[model samples]
Target: MSLVDLIARADERGLAASGLACLDRCVPLLGGDDEVLRPLWSSLADGGADGDAWGERLAKARAELDCADPSADTVPGLGPDPASGSGSGAETETEAETEAAVSDEDRAAALARRMLATAPGDPCASALRAWADACSAAALQIHRLLDVAADGDGPLVAAERRRQVAVLELLAGRGAGGLRPALEVSTEGRRVLRAVVSRRARGRS
Candidate 1:
């Protein structure tokens, strides 16, 4: 079935998992640790997205991602922290160059942040449906912005859509057990994104 159909048919848990998986996979773009969302995943497994555990874990994940704690925002995967004020001499020049280099990734990260924020803590069918739809658009847009391919329907967009559908299908088919496979799918996408970021850096140099 198509991604939309699968999402429509999915229960509250499936919808939440699908959206969280997408955002978790894209966390690398936000300079987050690979396992930052692991706790959230555990929450989903333990009691789904509407429980106290999910809320606690979600907040913890956001804090770990530097979304909750502004002081920790160091721009690990994307680029230099924008708030780091201009330095003098060579340092300033280097910062300027880095800033220019990661503009696309930064934009992509912003979209990822939006996806994370849009996720419903107390997810019901209606809320999960809206969040899932928004996440789909955000994930696609992030891929489009980060894609190095020439303008058009490139492989990156196709791959992302396929990944999205695959995650939904896995959730629909396997229930909680499917979280592991869904996470594996996200890991593969993360690797692809890391490679894309590296390729962009190489092209820049």
Candidate 2:
């Protein structure tokens, strides 16, 4: 089924998992640890998105992402390396490069954090649908920002859309049992993104 069809049919748990899994897999873009969203997954497993444990776990995940307080509204800076030296042309170039990289990372982190923050604590069908749509847009935007390709409608965007649909379909078809397979799909995407980041770094060097 198409992602929209699958999402339209999904219950609250499947919808939530679909969005959360997308963000969880993209955690690497935000410089997050791989297991950072594990607690949220446990909450989904225990009783879906509206479970008692979900809010607390979600808060914890936000905190770990340095987005604990929504009011903070600040993106963490990627500071210049101490060893890069001071007041030299090379140092200035390095600082500019670092800032640019940080800006991309911050943009990705903000989207991921928004995906978490916007999750309905007591998700209804309407709320889940809205969240899912927003996640689809955000995930695509994240991929676009990180993509090395100059073309906006390149392979990265296409792949992200496919992954998004696949996760939702996996959940819709298999219930909670689909979580592992969904995660595996996310892992593969993460590896692809890591390679992109590495290639960018190499180009810079």
Candidate achieving the largest lDDT: 1
| Model 2 residue pairs with clashes | none
Q: Using TM-score as the measure, which candidate wins?
A: 1
Q: Please, what are the lDDT tens digits per residue for candidate 2 over residues 81-185?
A: 122232233435656666666766576767667676666666677887777776777788778877767877678888988988888888877998988788788
TM-scores for all predictions: 0.79, 0.77
Looking at model 2, residue 61 earns an lDDT score of 79
Question: Ten-residue segment with the worst summed lDDT in candidate 2?
Answer: 78-87
Candidate 1 per-residue lDDT, tens place, 1-205, comes to 8878887888888888888878976887778878888888888888888899987787777777767642332342343333334323245566667767766677688768767765666677888887787678778877888775768647888899899999898888899988889988988998898788778878989
| Backbone clash total, candidate 1 | 0
Whole-model lDDT values for every prediction: 0.76, 0.73
Q: How many backbone clashes does candidate 2 have?
A: 0
Poorest stretch of ten by lDDT in candidate 1: 70-79
For model 1 the local lDDT of residue 55 reads 75
